[model samples]
Target: MLIMNRKRMVEDKLDRLTKGQTAYAESRELIRLVKREIQNRQIPVLMDETDSGCWFIPQKNTTTPSDEQLAQM
Candidate 1:
């Protein structure tokens, strides 16, 4: 006959999953960028319309930005 501890098995799996999620966050970066432009439309207002685009980028590189680059912001 074989016996197993289900509680211990579940706890072990949870621990592994937590570690994996931490590793993924440390190894990935999510970037959001947006661009905008002005346009004229038929309305009482001077500028009634605008154009914009947003992007979400998921990068795998974990490289830290240089001090000079970071200083520019």
Candidate 2:
């Protein structure tokens, strides 16, 4: 439940970031919170910055499947 709440908070902040409705200064704390949560949870995602604001993005998976695995798929 706590994890879910944290996830929701991160999502809300990301939404505001994407909408470009909040000032960067105001969103700084929110960005910090999101970053802390990401680190604490070991989430497989990253935060990226843009001219307008910042947003979350899925991290690229580093592992590659072997030939047998690919064939099974």
Candidate 3:
């Protein structure tokens, strides 16, 4: 009975560790996908760090092509 209890405790701990790792991996993948999308859209992002945490600021579009340039494209 004692051996069975020990085995169950070990399995429970392993399960918890596995779940934590899976969550971490999923979050990393999500961040990668978001970064890829931002790059693909050519969005300008400025990062700032403060005492608390980092911040992402989206810059304005100041270099839009003129109508003539668009027409040529």
How many angstroms is residue 40 displaced in model 1 relative to the true structure, after the best TM-score fit? 52
**Models sorted by TM-score, best on top:** 2, 3, 1
Ranking of all predicted structures according to lDDT, beginning with the best and ending with the worst: 2, 3, 1
- Model 2 lDDT-worst window of ten: 17-26
lDDT agreement with native, every candidate: 0.28, 0.59, 0.44
Model 3, 1-73: lDDT tens digits are: 4333433433443343334321111233333443454466555655444444333455555798999999999
**Candidate No. with top TM-score:** 2
Better of 2 and 3 by lDDT: 2
TM-score between candidate 2 and the true structure: 0.51
For model 1 the local lDDT of residue 18 reads 35
Worst 10 residues of 3 by lDDT: 21-30
Q: What is the lDDT of residue 5 in candidate 1?
A: 58
Over 4 Å off, model 2? 1-8, 11-26, 50-52, 70-73
Residue 47, candidate 2: Cα error in Å is: 1.8
Which model is ahead, 1 or 3, in terms of TM-score? 3
Per-residue C-alpha lDDT of model 2 across residues 36-71, encoded as one tens digit per residue: 765775656656666555666645458999999999
Stretches off by above 4 angstroms in model 3 are 1-26, 48-55, 62-73
